[model samples]
Target: MMFAEGHGLHPGHENLGGHIRFFNLDSGIFVRVRLPLLTDHCVLDSVEGLLVLQRDEDTAIHLLHPFTGDIVELPPLTSLAMQLKTDYTEATKLKLMRHISASISVADDGVVRVMVILIRMMRAAVATSQDTEWSMLSWRVPSHYQPLSTGGKQYLVHDTFFEDIDPDVAQVFQMEAHLQDTPKLIVTIPREILAYPVYLVECDSEVLVVGHNDMSFTHLAVHRLSDLVSERYVPVKGIGDKVIFVGGRALCVSSKILPPTTGNAVIYQHPRELTFSQYCLGSSTWSLATDECSMSMSGLTQGPCSLIPHVFTCCSRRHWNKGLMYWRDNEPLTWKVKQKFRDGVNHSHDPSLISPTRLFS
Candidate 1:
């Protein structure tokens, strides 16, 4: 979890021009850095490994590569704030920016394309670094459904059905996505769980839907999405030594690839609350990571698929997009799943974590 301006800013943090704290979910690690971009800025979210920041004074947008100290500026969202409502303040505008699912792409010409989909409005805005204003994307989500971004793509998911919005595509971290790629419903929820809230996420390149087993949100249920099959979604029994982070972006990574730890578990942060919990699928167990835990995995300098950019600065715009999209992170996930949420026991979580879900959630 990355902490920055307005979010998890400590008492002394306000004085730092730019400051961020990093926490690793799995291994319980924390790192803090100070970088001055302006007087103050809120770390709104992150795209790939870049921090998406909103300047407090002007509401301008910026993409910050924390490690390399690179910043890309976008126009202030003042116009957007007015478009969303007739009467509002900076606080209200910042609230609208919460949980927004955004995707970004840098073309072969160094032009950066970013798509921002407001959560409550379900309205999309598209902008490029070369443009002066944001253009609206005609896609508006249905009233009851929710928009989710997994595997660098966005989707609108509800209890019964979910389909891909198929946001921006310019080749990400070495993954080749084509402009011709279209969005479609990869799976539908079973009638049994239709009453529960369902969400879509990509783990190890496999799309999965997670939801609660009951109205209490007591347990979690997971299933894999298989578009190639008839019914589409296959029930996932276990993630097999792999850990799933159910915060910000639902990242499912291998234990060997990051801060190593015991796997086959799900770590989640409550959206409406500041509580975080870890659920063990195998033992059907639960543990409290923190009482004031709010998982963000967003890099704040306050900023992996290692997030470490090897050739971001000097690479040629023409060929680097292709090369960067496929940057090597060869870790793999292995395990068998039964497609059902098992009932297990509980345990105490690691206390070393200040806000444990940094990397996992």
Candidate 2:
């Protein structure tokens, strides 16, 4: 199952609201689930089927299970800012402006672990199921660190190097643990690729580092990190039989599990539309995922939208034969797009000029 959560008109602009939409890839069925509490909050990330939502007013973060309607409140952003000796107002503004990445994992013992990276400050906070508050951890690396999720575990990668954080200290906050150890460099980025804006995606235990060029095109480099000292980066020409979804988080899956057409492709969001485009790795070209693009404008006129790719699963392996499912939701418009023209030609659409008639009635 794949799900998308976004705020938009419910079949019409008569009512604007936020909803968690579920798409059954196999059955081609779409269901919209309303989330009232998250109506005004910003969804930072989704992991293990739970959304990390931050309240706009207070910068309070919470875990929301859209399907079960379960909410777990974490320590407010003010607490984290205080730990860094930063002003709360400025911290809030920074978070809203930047793309904040987070990772959520559930241990075998049922303990929920969450790690949120504050890009601006180069700091991170960890919250566990047993914690009453979030524990702030500062990164010693010069370049900013990005969080990656794979195999129910979270890892951080800087420019071209994988930085290993102490797992023992990550679970339980020990101030002394910060001085006891240093980050170990695991893999190095290939000299041929630009290292900035790199994204780490774990597929079937193999780590794939995707480097995005200035042209918005991507190159893939694979590595096996099972042994830190012996691991090395290997350049790959293509990803066989697997389609990767890249955005706030990178998800990799076998093409056999998804729709037939999605094989050997990378599904990523378009810069201008709420829709997604599939980049066929073999051809090194892109085409719209027409099925999903068709539903992008169903009830929306003009607004900012976000697509979250999710997979739903059942408890038993016997039921897994139903095949893999993908879901996505449209996010609400949070920023206004200013109309600008280049060379006396109208190059952009003004949200103010959007016609209500274009919305679904």
Candidate 3:
């Protein structure tokens, strides 16, 4: 799933193959575009009249009129420039500006809106906002395309590119039509926890993260997003695998949450020897799992959100699927530890486990 900040929406499609679903919370409408080909990339453009999809090199892009089911090519830049220069005249500027002002609502409310109008007038007086034949300039000219600042402001010139969108498509990041249609929200998560960030949906609940210094064993307490109630942390060596809670039960699941999969059999079987247990968000005492056994890297699947003492993950999978993975709950789901090998099957089997730091020091 890709999040578009400009549009204030998060749109995602299934990989391998799936339909596109656009959710605009403002409009309260979810639009679906079902195409025969996979979605490479999509933008809600305001260029007028067309919704375009340009695929990346990894996948071939197929464009179909979402409504008419007809194929259209993007207009050539050369012809498009000629048309914009010819039709966009002095009268068009006032009309476009009026439409633009009416369409946008600034963040500072009326104050910012008044300031922008003042700035526009100042620039126009100094021949900055409008001077020579900007409309006659190539679309690529910086003058032709207004600098899109940090707000929901878009500029519209003459309409030329829509002349023929039958066989050609332009690779673009932001589009006009889509931006005009959707309202977006920006959710900021800590960059450090981005890779394995877990999602929690609890109203007014606070997720706690505890940090322990490996050398001193001191506890550093951190409160996470209270609204969502999820905790994330970096794994430090020597912290035992366990999630503790203060007053509530903690919900833990397989390390994988996105696209929520089940039956970790996909990554189960021969697991890796876990050397560290990353202490993510948790309280001091994690609740007991239904099963009292230690959860290894081979067994976490789907379940209600709870606190896990510690979750285990494996990157290298030599025996099963490469990247075959699993999670070990603070408490085992079933009352059994079915590891393929016993802990002390061979005291002298592997040399890695015999290091001075591991065995003696």
Candidate 4:
């Protein structure tokens, strides 16, 4: 969890520079660092590793690590505050300032990457400063990158984002990926791009189980982690929506109108339609008459909403008013999940829980 430090400047300081502090519940440690203060309560601006508080002409942007006491000043054009369209009024800018913190995940390798959203302000629109954003903007810590020990208190990773950046662009980190050359097949089924994946199971270190985007079927693919490369995409399966790895078996979610279950169980919302029949893997086919629904073995990060990166399982519960939202796996949940709602949450076993060689065993 992150907490904003108060009392740095003055009591009535509205746009006072702020700092981000993080609390590790597992270790019971609280660390704080100086950051750019918010300029406006409504208009918040964020980029890859920085946050800006903007209200009218008074704007303060700070490039700081919430987990460490590192700070830098970013060029105006590169901050989200300056990326807004020329026609945008102060009110609209305030309304668009959104949270930019991304969930972090650790892979079998020690590398950590943070996913972010990037706005190609110049590429999207010439006249207006407002622009469309891409989801792939991410920051990462290489596997070999080591953190500096701060005396006997905390270990701090090097702040690479603060080093150098172009002044004309705004980048946001929304997700992270490990850069180990672990060979693995990643298949994005057609049409399932927007749906909550049903599952992500494991068969072996070499085999993975996943659902299709359409939420209509499932499939399996095998890969050798040692064969992985950079900026590469490999297909794993098609027409599936769920994946799970239990013992030696991998399960894929399928709503196909087949033996046990009949009729297309997928519901659709325009532009993104569901799939049809799918080939499910891992578990033996069962008759729906047995009165069995899907049982997830993973935990969901519940919030005002939930974001599922790939098909896995339901979060502890539903969001305030939405259904199962987007998926986010391999990331730690906030204290709200652990403390405020303990009984309502479910913990999933990590795929790495077993030996990678177990697949061959």
Count of steric clashes across candidates, in order: 19, 12, 33, 47
Q: Write the per-residue lDDT of candidate 1 for residues 1-361, one digit (tens) a residue.
A: 4432221222123344355555443454556666665235545555577777766566678888877889888877765665664365644554555435567777888888777766666566767787776665554543333444444466655342232342211111111111213234444455444224555556666766666665567777776645313554445778887767553235564555443234777766544433345677777777753322122222122112222111110011111111111111211000000100121111001111213232111
Candidate 4: misplaced stretches above 4 Å?
1-21, 25-57, 66-68, 76-87, 97-214, 217-361
TM-score of 2: 0.58
Cα lDDT tens digits for candidate 2, 1-361: 3243222221111243544455653344677777776545655555566766666456577888878889877766655655666555643433432244566666688776776655556555677767766677655423433456444555565552343542111110111211212334444444344344555666656866655433244433333344322433344557777766666456675665455445666676655445566777677677765454434432233222222233312111111111211222222121111111211322111122224332100
Residue 359, model 2: Cα distance from true site in angstroms: 29
Q: Give per-residue CA lDDT, model 3, range 1-361, as digits (tens).
A: 1111111111222331444443322232456666543333332221112233323221111234454566433321122123333355433332222211111222333211111111122121101111122122112211111212112332211112243532121111121211322212112233233211122211122232222222132222332332212233433222222222211112223333311222111111111222222223334322223232334333343234211222222111111111112233232212222221242222111112223322211
TM-score of each: 0.60, 0.58, 0.21, 0.28
lDDT winner between candidates 2 and 4: 2
What lDDT is obtained when candidate 1 is compared to the true structure?
0.48
CA-lDDT, candidates in order: 0.48, 0.47, 0.24, 0.25
lDDT of 4 at 122: 15
What 10-residue stretch in candidate 2 is worst by lDDT?
Answer: 315-324
Worst ten-residue run, lDDT, model 4? 148-157
Question: Candidate 3, 167: how far from true, in Å?
Answer: 44
